[model samples]
Target: MVKVKKIIFLALGFPNAEENTIIWTDLVHEFHLQGHDILVVAPASNKTDTGLRLEAGVKVLRVATYKLFDVGPVLKGLANIMLPYQYKNALKINNIKLDFDLILIPTPPITLGKTANWLKRKTKAKLYLILRDIFPQNAVDLKMISQGGLIHRYFRKKELKLYRISDKIGCMSQANIDYIKTHNPKIEAAKLHLLPNWENLPKFEDLGNIDDIKAKYGLTNKFVVIFGGNIGRPQKMENIIELAKNCTEIKDLVFLIIGKGTEFKKLKDNVTSLKLFNVVLEKKIPKKDYYNLLRAADVGLISLSEEFTIPNFPSKVLSYFGSKKPVLASIDLQTDFGQMLEETNSGFWAEAGNIPLLKEKLMLLYKDGDLRSKLGANGYKYMAENLLPEHAYNIICKNV
Candidate 1:
């Protein structure tokens, strides 16, 4: 069989966390191994030097992004929406031309489709739309966009264009494929494939010491439940705060919320004002340390809106499994993550904002070491057998 010569990937978001960075890095590595040249373009949120060189066989270009309205929700979304254009200009400034065989794009307002569309014309690359998050649908769920209005209509057109133009799609779950098929039947069934979230299992080692991190964060001997990474607008956390304030019976269960986003300030302010003793907030820790800390936790927590029930799958579930810890998910039971947890016995499940149920599950997991261990082990086994990062790349390359 003949091989593709070159590939280009564009991720129009901030690159800080290892989880996000590793996806593209691993993809580049895999394609390079298959004898393909790779190019990556990601926009930088902070003031940084522009231009680029090759690293690990893949060329990386970080474009400049302006600070408008201080990373608040309104402005933050706009910034993300504007990144492809910023990236385009960044490419022009650096005199880097991308004429490649394949292109992968992520969705938010579905504007990345525009970038892919442009690249397809220039390079005639076979496009693969990485369905990371469902866009206008998510905004509509969050009430950020009116479903029937002109704004929604505008974004919906872009969403459809993305689906129509891409040669193939990589989705997190089967439900996501069904969602696209239901919404847009024009996409060929053969082109849709499952590309689940994966863990870099070997990069993580057993860091047995938890007490040091606990003491540093004032969480010594506490039954910690961690919700780490990206404390953003989509996370409706007020209900979680109310749980900490009201569910005084589960006092030993300490809640840790780590990571930075637009919601951090308001979340911290509310916790301070209420004087919640058990809930602690902190910035995102270094990657290796964070994974180590996750292993030490009694449970990992994730929340997804009911509106996101169909197409969205939180990667945190896979990360929680990678840490060999059980998940306490506040999400729709109808979705893949919930189904996985229930079927594999990997974690507890509760509806988003269902404080009473969340509290109950948290207490049960904290008290029963055997049950939590069994659940955690189940998830670990699943991830080890199927969901490593290298495995995801193999699947993507094989399909492509």
Candidate 2:
């Protein structure tokens, strides 16, 4: 029999938020199904006070904190600094005490190191740090923060503390693992493990007909290229605008962008100013509707800022695979997602900000229905064999 363990999860995004159906969602659900007790401590959406709620048998404690994304840098920084303290105070006020077997925390703010350290000390829990975003370095890469500056130094300190406290560190890919090891030479190699993002397999009955949904979205007869999920700074939306501009004369080719973030309005304004008839920008839709759009589209578009040295993997690719839509990823040179695309025969990839290359790839998919179908089928097969929640669950279980 498997041993039942109590796990504490610290995350900024949870169910009902923009990240409703992504990595954290699937992981929490899987843990619950495996008969593990989960306690999730997340930031409250509206207020700065803690509240307790239960969802799908997991206990979630929403701590009062400021919004991280879609906010000014100063406010976001302040919120990140306060989250650790707020989490501690909230737990105390609720009188919640448990001997947790494991404490899992994913990095973005990197402020939770102190909180995770405290919990581990109190409960003797093993700390598992999921290094999704490599903090200050990624910020520095985008010129959002300067290396060796006061802010960078402050966050770097927190990042090191977090790594030091973690008994095991799970990286999204081999590139991420190499990045941490190269940057933080003091980190022990034994602690690092590969833990890719995963999702539950989609049932065939729920996928519905692509043609029916295409008609509903008025995408019928058009070679729709859909970009869904967060439209943030890291996505480099300008590159997408360039693609739209180049493809405007191709009346049969349509670009559908569905998502919201700090860059949404900027991207919308650019598209309008350019008078790109082939491009359409819409706010994030309901999950079911989003999936329908995914199926309706002929190609899924994934973009990352070319400035990034870190290999950032977008979980949006999983959605494309789930919907059996071929992906056309524009990625940074450091990322190996392009290689993954090649290995799986899942579609095509071009260097981000290369508008000409993007346009060429888009046209290739538009002209060949057989190529699109073959690539989409390959992606679905790859996702089923590899990127399932069960794979990630087994990895976490082995470490714990």
Candidate 3:
């Protein structure tokens, strides 16, 4: 006989249950498909979206709170700080009375530590912290929050409490594991495991015609290079505009950016101001739409701010691999993501601020179709072998 565990998933961002954005949804849905019971707890996306509901057969509790992202920093911080208490009250009002076997938590808001601890104490479930964004420290690195200040001191306690309470800390990369071990020497190595970001390879019925999709986005006549994810401070999207500025004379090439975040307006304004006709900025679209855009483009782009010290791994690369599209990244050196690209031959990268090197790599891919195909194939093979929700499913289940 096999165990059909009851799981609780906590996240700041989640898509509609029927749709798969290939982030946390896939992993939790994999558990659902495997006959396990799962419940998701998240902040309400809008005014009318509050309370309990069933989504794709899984119970989802959308706590009435401030919307999580795509807002100013002050509002974002308020949302994070209030999330735990908000969730606590929501659970009580909704009469959530199940015994959960395991709880999965991902970080961006470490303020959930208090709630996670309370839940574990109540449900007697093991807690797994999916350590995606290291907090307080990452904020300090970005110069968003001052070190040794009142706010930093408060969040620093939450950070430690989260780690201390989590039965297992699943890091996005080995670099993440090492950084934690170095900075927080009291944390035991036994609990920290390498849990890379994963995605379920989608089964789209129609990818649409490449030329039609390209024309739909005004990319029909150019060798399109696309960046398809959050346009935020951590992404250092300025490097993207700089790359566009450098490539203005390359008439055959165009840069396509599709996503919305804090920096979206700034990037749009800069694109208009620079008169860089080679660049196109579009709002973030559904995952299905993004796949078609991926298919129509010649190359994928990933950019990270140079200020980051955490070994951050953005899951966007998996989308390129799934579509067999080669990537070009300008990212911080702290992350081993660049090295992963080098090892897999999936793409090329330069340190985040290095526009000259980014331009060089972009040209190499732009000129060589054969090389692009080979690299893309290599990435596809790697993703198939290692980056699926099934892999994550096994990791979480076995560990718990």
**Candidate 2 residue-wise lDDT, 236-271, digit = tens:** 989988888887788888999999988898999998
Off-target runs (Cα >4 Å) in candidate 2 are: 1-4, 16-20, 48-50, 203-212
Worst 10 residues of 2 by lDDT: 13-22
| Lowest summed lDDT window (length 10), candidate 3 | 1-10
Per-residue CA lDDT of model 3 for 1-400, tens digit only, reads: 1253788888788766776554877887888899988889987778688888887877788877885776777788988899899888988899988588888898877988888899999988889898888989888988889999988898999899888898898888899999999989998888999888898775656766878777877887789898988888888899999999999988989999998888899999999999989988889666666788888788989998899988889899998898888999999989999989999999999998889999999999999999999998998899999989999888877777
Candidate 2 pairs with clashing backbones:
none
| TM-score for candidate 3 | 0.96
CA lDDT, every prediction? 0.75, 0.86, 0.86
For model 1, which pairs clash? Answer: none
TM-score of 1: 0.90
Those runs of model 3 whose alpha carbons end farther than 4 Å from true positions after fitting are 1-4, 19-22
For each of the candidates, the C-alpha root-mean-square deviation to the true structure, in angstroms, is 2.8, 2.1, 1.7
Question: Candidate 1, which ten residues in sequence have the lowest lDDT sum?
Answer: 14-23
